[model samples]
Target: MIFLKLSYISQSRLTGLFSLVILWTLSTNTWAQKIIRAPYIQLAKSNSVLIRYRTDQATLSEISISTDGKTFNPSIKSTNKVSEHTVAVSSLQANTKYYYRIHINDQVALGDSSYFFKTAPTVGSKDKISIFSVGDMAAGETQRKIYNAYVNRQKSNYTNLFITMGDNIYCGGSDGCWQEDFFNPYHAGPLLRQTALFPSTGNHDYDNQAFPYQQDDSNMAYYQNFTLPSQGELGGIPSNSEAYYSYDYGNVHLVVLDSYAWGKDNFRIFDQENNIQLNWLKEDLKATKQDWKIIYFHFPVYTKGTYDSDVSGEIIKLRDYLTRVFDEYGVDLVMSGHSHVYERSRPLREQYGLSSEFSPEKNWPFNSSGRYDGSDKSCAYVFQNVEPKKKGTTYVVNGCGGQTAAHRFNWPHPVMEYSLDKRGGSMAIDIEDNRLDAKFIDEEGEVLDQFTIFKEVNKITKKTINAYDPIELKASWPGPANSYVWSSGEKSQKINLRPLKTSTYTVTDTQKCLQDSFEITVNPPLGTTKWEELIHQPFESLEIYDLLGRTWKSIQKEGFIDQSVMDGLPTGQYILEYRLKGKSYTLKLIH
Candidate 1:
């Protein structure tokens, strides 16, 4: 009886445990089919939108979305697959916000099931966008912590997209690594529900069986992860195949390119032949009319980090060609990665040497400056004067995303405006009015660097004017000819003049810009002595002086020194005239 009782108890315990296991699985997978993952809504046209999402598990059943959660209305145009699906919600009003949800049913209509989404406004709308970017993200404790902190603090109402620059995983690539490096760090936060990640194929992400060994691998896990804009010119191939494309976000035009495709090993293998991307670039930039044009790729053209120009390399060649193209068109800013450091540059021209002065001539190519200098003296001063000198372009290397410190760079990296190698950082750019302010922010929310870029409304105004000379001309006598006063207010001496009618006379020289007037009334009375006549004359020759004042020439018609006299005198400063009546009189002249 005891043995039988023990057996019954053991059987009961095992049965109870099995029942709990089944219940747990059912609970987790209850709404898994209809409750999709990574539900993303992209703006299309006329309030119409495209919704892309991945299902929890495979399902061949037709899927649909409910405008109202209570109805089992299925969208007719939706393309459904076992793993992925896309549906278009259309015929809605422009700029109007609507709430809808996703639905998937296999056996019977699954009513009351959905995920919320909103359609985008019509073209030219003043829509606000919030985006995040990262590069060199690998699986690590601190990286994961920072990522979690960032997403937790972010607001989901307007956050639209996230960009992942290369080196997304470490140790080449593996499915397990991706799960740890990306999904794990993001799982704790609300990021997956709000923002969709757009990733470029990094070297590590390509080094796994998840993507085929072929260069034009159609089966990469990165491709399956996000849905990018699907309509643009890209190597004459479908947008999905060519990962390079352009998109409009509010007033900014963004261009994303694949820098790795230009490498020798990758170029021939991927068959990225004929420079199709370059032609597309020129055409795209020419046609774009946005307030700002920003481009991003995985390789930096300039950096003072682990990745330095080694004289002869593919990067140097790429820089030469790329800089010419970017400068030819007014590309406002270019961002890149692969250096495992963060850096910004001045409005750079050929780095070989600086221009004669501030230059707006964009045709000049960037020259090689070899290596960074040891001190930041010159660069620091230049940075101080770094105003909005013309339309400046900054090259940012944002590769210090999630990795160990690669290398330290000394100051004086050509075109380098700022550099930092510490990890756990990102940037925020705010576009307001015609000026764009970008702040480099670290994980702790500290501002590393802040700078502003201005839109060229009209070319800077230029003007020039002449200043007037301050010298004045005092006086001259009939008495003084070719007379002028120095700026010091001094007088000039007896100037030889052919006294015609000893009457008031005015002398002016516009070329020399001098003017003077003299009143000499010679009324020789018949009775009085000539000296008395001269003394009382309006031309009172009381005191006289030679040009240098070293000699004196006086003529009192009374003591009248009958003069063929005073013929020789050098030109200089002197004093003359007398107190006629009550006022003091004076004359100056250049002999």
Candidate 2:
């Protein structure tokens, strides 16, 4: 009996040992399914964020989010078999920190410490915003240096946005290059996983050799990997194409254009004649009531880098064409890359001619000194808040994020206030209220250049009056004022205007250097006898229906259209519907 019991014990021990080996093998296999490319965050909105990652093997992916850094809730899940996984977690709170983890096939791929992202503040909130801008990154050590420098200097929690000017990859924009040069440098580190990257497309991003203008198979990697605002869901016009888009953060309106692609194709912008982008841009700018407007793209309008703005036909064309649109729409700052140097211009206006023909009186209306002291006593430039016209805009070429190339021509452009090519760096912009402060920091965390743009707050009261009714506009300042100049060329604090039609008047304070604009909309009484002759604004739609609600005539047109349909209308009461600026109005008319 003792021998039998001993044999049973030995068999039991063997069974236990075999079970341990099986468990060990399973754990080793699970670890071997490592994530080739760790998860990164993108398109961080007020209530949503896109998480993307790649694994060595195709697996079901999921993400868990937690606000208290513990007790994570499974927010998003995808069952598709994909090595690359992208999932968007939505309905999150604004301006809140969220800790997240990646799980592939129910196994933890990445988790634990420091994996968190803060959602953007509520739109139009007065919260102070900080942004980092860099370009020509994703090379090697230099790119890492620039990124590290920015991360070291900036507060870990305060940074709200991160933007890349262009050239996100080096040599060729192939999948392999993106893996090694772009993703590994930014995503393999901690920056992109926390703060999303908003990138502009450079020539190198679309295949350096081919430089394909249109989005096709050559640039599929860029188009598929990065997602941007395109549906006008973020306070801009619907671009419908990810190549060019816009978004709003607080009171700042950011316009990102396809300067390299669209400019190279045909200098087509949203404001260009017959271009859809131009039309959308015009409407978008008109709709934006923000206090600050910033535009960024890949190519520099004014640069003295490897390519000369004056000599290069493409550069000159883009500069002249875009400057007009930017100035007309009151763009505050323009940021660009592709120059491989850092150049900041003074507040420039109407500098459409070549560099040799640039005139300070016409172009450099603001102080030519690159430095803008924020104090009221030493303020350099005071841009007006009026629409369709701004005093000036500051252009910055910050392409030295990854690589630096010596300027071929004279170091600085005529309007340049600061220029540097020796070191690579990034730009930090802090926007608060009506003031925008920008700093250029080198790889060593040194402030190489700094400037500020201040916009004086302007308040104008809008007035609506009936046609033939004279309207008097009285301009008053909160503080002591000296004189006022109206856009009608009147130098008076009180201007009496008799307008037969709608008009806009801008009044500028000659003493305080402040300006305000008011619009006078003259509309005739709803039911006037002037049916045969009616003045209509461009893009206005008109429709006429009988009392029975039967459609008699409909005209979807712009400008003046003769009321010829009135002649065919029966001699009875008819309803006239007019649509303009997204508002519809009904009027009772008799024929």
Candidate 3:
């Protein structure tokens, strides 16, 4: 190639040299950056985030970060020339908002005040986190509506996190399908730039020509298109595989699993005793110490929506294998989306069988609507610290994020306390301390359903203390409750009492979200000190307890005890708990 002054070129030779110049001019267009796919955020952590984008041709990629939109730090540049670009920016403040921009070949391609993201809060931080999730949202107007609805509602409180329950793309999950159905809708201008996408795998994501569906686990478009917290960047055990992983946001531990059949192996997640995915999940669940544990995946363990959980193959297996693990670990929530509907269950446990075998009395140990709205025996599910590890788990089938209006027979499974299949919506979950609130926001921006769960709340206890002993009572439901009022008309978090006799006291929050009761019984000196005197007094109820705390005798009568009855008692140490003149008393007697 040669460039010479036009005037110096001879007329006969100008035509030959002109073709080279023309070719060079056309080749310059390739140098210009053509961003085919807009920038998206991913792999978010307390102090780092990953930004990924695609271009039409090879070009230099650079990213600039700033605390304010007007000012930016030195740009982070990658010299590698490639169509796909991933820039991981680290060494930042935790839970801090920052503006960013992408520069393709030294020109600003994406950046502004509106295009900013907030880093995840420090692990185990008390800061509140808002998460919005959708499932089976491939391509449709409904998907856009759901996205816009959440964005509109986020004006007052911005949430920078988003998750998907898979089937992210339609029609064989091709690269073009991903761009058209997924990347375009959440393109940089709308959501993807600000909100990090943490996605799970669905069968449709593995659908290749409908024949090789889920036949290639490592080669699926879903695995190729995104990078997640697979290396323990967010605080769980490093899975080293994208199939399943865990991430921590504030005090919440989010476990994303892959239940789809892996390539040609004809595998279920836990089909074998020593499966890699299952083993990773167990380690991840065991390793996370976050206050709230939530697991999300593609196939719902229990549902009677468009798909039947009772008869489905993988669904039944999920129920058989996963519930026991979740119960053993005290998993707070289990969310999935294969069925096309909205269904939520009461806190369930020991429920592993066909749908017809679902016994509410046996499965739902703490049964209630869990709406906390005072309608139809509605009460928040409580997780006591001393309760069994198999406390209860709330299973949610939120598959209708973009698809809806489908149902099977028995649309509302017996295990579910709330069910809705008329509209399409996504879930908005808010967590802070011991409380979690979730609402299903419909496409039209209406709240279709909502539920609340409280941990270590609404307690009742019985204590036996010596007379005039000081007993301190503390209210549960997280520290610094909205407002606390005790039965003694006190307005404090804790109260110390020195009662001469036994009495019952109760404390309730202003909103009545939680209540704690103390049934106090004042005990006399050891060894029948007051037994003789109390035997001649009238009492309402007398309870005789053995040294092992078992009730040996219970007499509910408004009469005095005779000496003959005391004499007839066997020789042993006993605890006498009797109410005399409306005041409870306890005495240790050796008969």
Candidate 4:
């Protein structure tokens, strides 16, 4: 270190020397550690996330991050010298947004306000989750447009995670293809920077120029580039292998299967009995208790797009085996991308036959459009554990993320309710509580098709009322049910009726796919019953009804209700009934 005498050094000279030193240090550090690949997020969880990037040469990597941009904490990690850098930051708050910047040799490599990530909501939290998924999205003009459409749709509200249904890189599926096709398009937007990736494998992703064009994971660029949560890292059974895995986000459980023969001695998803991949899938599905289970892979179980599911080799196996598993486990959605067209089937089960053999009466229980847009008979698919459990899986072939062309022969399978050909689009799924919305948004930001699914609806109820007494029944599903029809000829969710005698009333949604029944029994004028009135004794059960026999108030095991409980009641004649000592009592009360 050289120091000039304070008496001889002028202020101007001293300032100039300090500036020169700072500039030199920054320039050297930046030039030495040139970032080859921008930072991309991976394996994000409720409290942690992994960031991976590549540099020109081996250098120390550090991250400066903060919840609010006003302050930041730098975590100096990766002391080893390496071109590829993976930095993990932990102990973060759940479902929080954070801004981050990569520092190479203590110099800023990439950072901005837009460079931020939001953690996944707490594992089982009911927070609304938005997911974006695409298949066959090989980087090209159409791919970029689809990406832009998503970016435009989500200006500030970014997806919690993005999933690729395989075939991410086109052509040879080498490093060059990944750089130009995958990174080039993603780096131009906030998708990779802000969203964690969960990708499956496709046939083209295994293409390699090396000996044996279909190379193993060791030589496959697809495996080498991704850092998957393979070991129950994101809330699922430990898969150990990247070939296929499962993870949870909010209340959704997503399973990404490697349909292509690439893992464990090249065992494909369609292998015969005791297939390793299918075995793991069965175990995982059995273990997870999540509200929603979504399975995605490259081979579609039902499609009539570029490839016919009835004739395709792997799809046939998937249909024969996977449908049973999906139906057994009550899987909500099964997605795949290989046909280069869009096709969505009605909620179906056990239709593994050829297209000509499809029987809607047996295979598809919910045959509505499911658009929920007021179109003819269009209503959301409302599911429940009602008597005659109508648990079915909706199959989607979202293969038009990159390229779309003329559909194959018999483009729309008999099971499909909607089909779109020659349209490049991406799938956006929003899940909150029991309601899920899925949309196929075209490259022009137009929602070509959409549908809704509701879970845990009660299809049956029972009540006893006096003759000519009215009772109110409410629909269990959310949203306005005005388009529905009830046995009373009412077209709304809540309806009131006074049945003259014991009878059952039924209500059906607009699509006629959902139905609810109420069994109301008329009690033969309980006013004439002979029982000791509970004047001062606390009753075990009590119900108050107006002259119309409509239940105004009801309670069980509440001990007693004071006059204040009737404050809201109108001044009219009322009937109070109570059950005590295993006996019933009725009194005419005038309010």
Give me the candidate number with maximum lDDT.
4
Write the number of the candidate with greater TM-score, choosing between 1 and 4.
Answer: 4
* TM-score of each predicted structure versus truth: 0.57, 0.69, 0.75, 0.75
User: Candidate 4: minimum summed lDDT over ten consecutive residues — where?
Assistant: 2-11
Candidate 1, residues 168-241, lDDT tens digits: the string is 77755654566566765654454443343455655566776442343335455554544455354211122333
lDDT of 1: 0.49
The residue pairs in collision within model 4 are: 469-548, 469-549
State each model's CA lDDT, in order.
Answer: 0.49, 0.71, 0.75, 0.77
lDDT agreement of model 4 with the native: 0.77
Q: What is the lDDT of candidate 2?
A: 0.71
Q: Write the per-residue lDDT of candidate 4 for residues 357-451, one digit (tens) a residue.
A: 88989887775788988787777887777634566899998888897877888768889998999999999998887788999999999998898
Question: Candidate 1 at residue 180, lDDT?
Answer: 61
Ranking by lDDT: 4, 3, 2, 1
Q: Lowest summed-lDDT stretch of 10 residues in model 2?
A: 1-10
User: Model 2, range 350-436, lDDT digits (tens) per residue?
Assistant: 888788887877787665353443333434455654632337889999999898888977768988878888689999998876667
| Better by lDDT, candidate 4 or 2 | 4
How well does candidate 4 match the true structure in TM-score terms? 0.75
Runs with alpha carbons beyond 4 Å of true place in candidate 1: 1-37, 40-49, 60-81, 90-100, 106-127, 152-157, 171-177, 209-216, 233-241, 262-274, 310-312, 350-389, 408-412, 456-591
Candidate 3 residue-wise lDDT, 1-591, digit = tens: 111111111111112121121110112235667778887877777777767777777776677878867777776466456666666666778888778878877888877677788888999997888888889885788888888888787775767578888777666778788888888987723568787788887878877744434533445567667777667767899876666778888889999888876523455685764667777788888888899999999899988898899888767887888998888788999889978889999889888888899887788877567777657667677788887742689999888878786689977899998788857888998887788988889899988778888887777888999854458987766535436889988878888876656789999876566799999998864556545665676788888776555667788887676675475567777777788777887777766
What are the runs in model 4 whose C-alpha is more than 4 Å off?
Answer: 1-31, 209-216, 387-389, 458-591
Count of steric clashes across candidates, in order: 11, 3, 1, 2
